[model samples]
Target chain A: MTVLEFDRITKIYNVRGAGQMKALDEVSFTLESGRTLGLVGQSGSGKSTIAKILTQLETPTTGRVLLDGEPIPRHGKALRSYRQQLRMVFQDPFASLNPYHSIRYHIERPLQLDRVVPADQVDAEVRRLLERVRLDADSVIDRRPHELSGGQRQRVAIARALASRPKLLVADEPVSMLDVSIRLGVLNLLADLQREEGLGVLYITHDLATARHFSDEIMVLNQGRVVERGPADEVILNPQDPYTRELRAASPDPEKHFATAARDQGGAR
Target chain B: MSDALLTVRDFSVVYDVDPPVAAVKDVTLELRRGEILGLAGESGCGKTTLAYGVQRLLKAPAVITSGSVVFHDASGADIDVNSLDAEQMRRFRWDKVSMVFQGAMNALNPVAPIGRQLEDVFEVHRPAMSRAKRRAEVAELLEIVKVGAARARSFPHELSGGMRQRVMIAMALALRPQLMVMDEPTTALDVLVQREILRQISQLRHEFGFSVIFITHDLPLLLEISDRIAIMREGEIVELDTAERIWTDPQDGYTKTLLSSFPRLTGERGVVVR
Candidate 1:
């Protein structure tokens, strides 16, 4: 079983005039295969910083991340090999996808680079990946990113991420840009794929409700510090941290909001 | 005064593209005074098109094909919105109806102090007001939105995202318009900030007694604050009702689908919302 451990990752940024700014403070967590960990916080909470550090975009000021108990390689083939095992899914599908590249090309490059399949089987692998994401491979293969809707584009992104056959997937705000109606379908597909592949998934989003719904565990970050972490239901239903409670309270849950509103109106009358 | 502050009758808008497409089709709705009317739909559903058509804000290829939008002026006049000329429309716009667009915070001038930008509203519309009076009006407006009178001197970039959004709301309320059209006003903000903005809007509406047209794809958000909601699908309004009714007993299949789209905080992991 594959295990990804993020141990005490702290990131400090040197601002122009602001001196040292702590973007992340001693944040630590772990994810095992077949489990989903939801990282949630407001903007500037350093949730994205964790994703960046994991992807090697930014090095931690202190602490380190280990995959299978091995430090991530700094450069060359080892770094490339390390990257091959962990892939990223960005937030905006429209921007993340290349406008000039065909959907087939987007899915094929990762497979070709990672050499997941033989050169002859690359086309078939692309088809399989597209089909896995529930897209019609025959129809969407030649189309550009703009040709597909936002939901379809995001699905293509997921397929591309899976093309590498990574053990851990870091999805940063996957469906935040999508229309609310189609977000469920995409999320359900991701959940299904996660279970089927036994992939350790890091679902990062600011949306508390969805985090609670999809994640096995929820971690709350506040201004670059881990404020709360626990089982999803426990954290959401009876949050220990005041920040988590405020987030839960602020989230627009119709059932809770309406029920409370009705009681308050009744009491007022 | 009539309860209906604004009535849109048989309104339609079409994009003058190759083989022309009808973006909004025969949409009829009324905004009651002091009520928050929500227009909800997915992208390309024509809710935005209908709103733009009502305000004659569509430019170029987008044209209003048919119907009239009438405003029930508090001065006991039924003003035909489409008939107003350029100057009259300008006067009619900020003076009677204002808009807070999606990502409107970015619309502020970066070089100018936010206070100066707010004062420009009075400078242009209330042309006879002195400069000092305009500044004070802007300070008062800023305070009303809780951006603080001191923030007037600060540039747009100086304020946080939520504060910048509040500044936009202050600008919209500068003229004290009777109707405010907010198209996805708080969609860009975080959950906590979004709730704060919504609460501020609700409170302001209570004090000012002005109607609001809030548009977004988020049905749960509308269900939280909107008094009445119009569910649009494929350029047509399929359902219109109170938020409580829409939440409890949605009539249209599309509306039901939209409501169920949100993943609930408590329920089966893969399926169903609360």
Candidate 2:
């Protein structure tokens, strides 16, 4: 089943002195249940714009978004209900989390706001959620955001997002701010969560290598348009678009391919 | 590459809080002329702290507890950066050694025009030069970084992220410093833009004959560009070797684990047993 469908979405911003900017242009894609769609793009490629639209933070200029085959209402009671089914984990964990609040408060507020559990049961649910994200409940519950490391703070953000028990998740460059050594661990956690919860995820990133490893389907966006879309492996290995090929070639390789290429040229000389 | 252009010996940085915390401990490394030295570590591993220590940019809360950073100047004078006063250090900062910071978007002033920012650097450092000569030099600097001269008139907000990064590089390269310290310069950019920026930095180093201290967490990127790689763990340098040796035979367990954590595109998934 299609958990989320975006049909012909476009976003235009009008500048007062400058002309209008077309941020997103007629983008269309479908995210299936229990699968991940990796949206790959550069800084201005409308990847973040799509994530905001999916999370209902911003309305598209022209298009419709459907959740489980029903159109999401623009405002009022129905929109609030639709929002309860989707949640977003922002790119910057340091900025997304409140500095003054404890981890327990951050996690429990979402549960209480959504009315996911009773006041007495909210503490237990928060602890369970913390454990689900591999954070120790006793050690981490009372600590503030400043006390935790970047990775730990991100895991708390993830737990807070999962507190709603939403069917769909939109993670916008979740690990880009993290260190390289811990990035894979977080990616692994996200993949495991998707598998266990059977949640549809829109994984947005500019890193093709990680997207290829993590996502079932990949969509390459360039200048507000879908340049290529297919199975993640197929699109990465056999990229049809020149833009996609350039992006792939630019990515750093762990196997020292460039050094070998330089060595081969030297040997030939 | 010859004997170290910059030698950091037994360097340690401590934060003077209510209780002191050592950010960098007994770290030692060398950067040769016209060679790139890559510093790799996780967050809070003191990579940035080490960079700040070298330039004496660390403020009051952070104190240099011990050791010295010696820079071999163009006239063959060995200057200890730690001993320099604020006025002397200001003169040495951009004229002899420069820095290109991460998040070029935030580094540039939003209200100021790009040309004016570049002119400010020239005005402070090279006040003897004529205004027209300064403009020509600014245009040349922009051209060297592949940014058009027309962009000098535009504000920081008018340019894209990649373009702003190029402007940052141009500003750093304006005075033709002997050494450049880049702290995660391309982390905020995309893959293609990152590659382009790295290639430009490599070319600039070749043209100008300045050494580089490149700090980043991306091992693959460091392997691609650096001549020597130094792995930092907690508060110390764990391993310092050539890029080839560091990749194949890392000495420390933490270094090995960091190398193994990178997800491979064309190999067995998670086969890198730490």
Candidate 3:
């Protein structure tokens, strides 16, 4: 069953001088539990607009967003409860986490607000969340965000996101800020958690490579429009759209291109 | 590429905290006259400190305890960067070597036009040049980086991120320094823009025979652009070899882990086994 459905959602931002900027032009897609939907797009492609609409951070210019066959409420307690089931992981883990608070505080705040578990069980649940994200609760629980590495901080961010027991996660450019060496670890952790928890994930990113590996299905966004949509492998490996082809060509693969360049130069010498 | 442009020996930088932390330790490397030397490491691995130390750009508390940075000019003069006085270092900084810092695209002054910023580089170094001559040079530099003459009048926020980064590159190449030290130059840009910038850098390097000390955590990008790669772990250089050797047969365990951490598109997806 589809957990969240963005039904013909369109977002328009009316600027003073710029006039109306159509951020999302009638974008529509549905995400199911135990499945991942990758929204692949570059900057200003309305990827974040969709994420904002899903979390009800912004009201759609037109159309509707349905959750479990019911249209999402605009205000009041319905919106509050709807947000509990939907959590977002941002691009900058450093900024997302409060530097003043401990890792436990960040994770427990969500659990306390949502009342996901009993008062006494909150600590144990936090520990479980930490372990699930491959972080040692015993070592990192008491430490603030400043003390942790970039990778560790991201893991903590993930743990905090999972504290509310979100059914649908909207992670927008989550790993783009991370270093190359540790990006896979976080991606692998996300993929693993999605499978284990049977949660629907809206993985929004500009990168085609990680999206192909993590997402079950893919949607390519360009200038606030869905240019292409299909299974992840089909969209990535055998892309039909010209924009998708350009994205594929832009991806840096040193082994295929750089390694051979070195070989050719070495042979000539 | 036969002659060494810059040679660093036994360089170490220590931050004077309570216990004193050594950020860089006994790092020795050489950059040929026109070769690109890639420095690959994690965030706190001291790549930036090493680059700063080589040019005597380190400030107080972050002391370069012991090091020797020798720059060999085209006329074959061995100039010790460490021995240069404050005034001499000021003159030597951009004339001999220039740096494109991390997030340098945003480092452009928001209020001033990009043309004036490009002109400032030449104004400081070549004070004798006529205003008309400097204007012509500034326009030429902007065009060289592919920003075009029209972008000169535009503000920093008006241009795109890639164009701003191109302006930074144009300014860095303003003086035509022998060595260019870039720290994660294209990290902020998107994939397509990043590809174009890398291509532009490669093209610029061929056009202008300047040695580059390129530092980035992305090993594959380094392998693609750099002639040689240096892998730093903790505060030390664990391995330094040709790009081909480093890619094919990494000697150090840390190097192997660093390379394996990056996921690839061609290979088995998510196969970067910990």
lDDT for each residue of candidate 3 in B1-274, tens digit (9 for 90 to 100): 2389998999999999989999999988888889999998988899988988899888889998887999998767889998899889899998889999899877999999999999999899999999999999989998899999888899999999999999999988989999899999988887889999999998999999998999998787788888999999878999999887888888999999987876666657646221
lDDT of 3 at A229: 99
Which residue ranges in model 3 land beyond 4 Å of their true spot?
A259-269, B270-274
Best by TM-score: 1
Best prediction by lDDT: 1
User: Given candidate 2, what's the lDDT at residue B238?
Assistant: 89
Candidates' DockQ values? 0.59, 0.49, 0.54
Instruction: List CA RMSD, all candidates.
Output: 1.8, 2.6, 2.2
Angstrom error at residue A21, model 1? 1.0
- Per residue, candidate 2 scores C-alpha lDDT tens digits across A1-269 of 54688999999989799899888899999987689999998878899889888878899999999888798898987887778778888889999999999999999988998899998999899999999999999999999999998899999999999998988889999998887877888888988898889888899998887888888899999999999999988898889999988888888885746557558888621
**If both were scored by TM-score, which would come out higher, candidate 1 or candidate 3?**
1
CAPRI class assigned to model 1: medium
lDDT of the structure predicted as candidate 1: 0.91
Question: Looking at the true structure's interface, with contacts defined as alpha carbon pairs within 8 Å between chains A and B, what fraction does model 1 recover?
Answer: 0.67
**Residue-level lDDT for B59 in candidate 2:** 91
- Residues A116-146 of candidate 3 have per-residue lDDT tens digits of 9999999999999999999988999999999
lDDT by residue (B52-114, candidate 2, tens digit) is: 898998898999999989998878888899889989899999998999997777999999999
Q: How do the residues A1-269 of candidate 1 rate in per-residue lDDT, one tens digit apiece? A: 98988899889999998899999999899988888999999988998889999999899999989989999889999999889989998999999999999999999999999899999999999999999999999999999999999999999999999999999999999999998888988888889899899988999998888888888999999999889999988999999999999998888888887778779888621
Number of residue pairs clashing in candidate 3, backbone atoms closer than 3 angstroms, sequence gap of 3 or more or interchain: 0
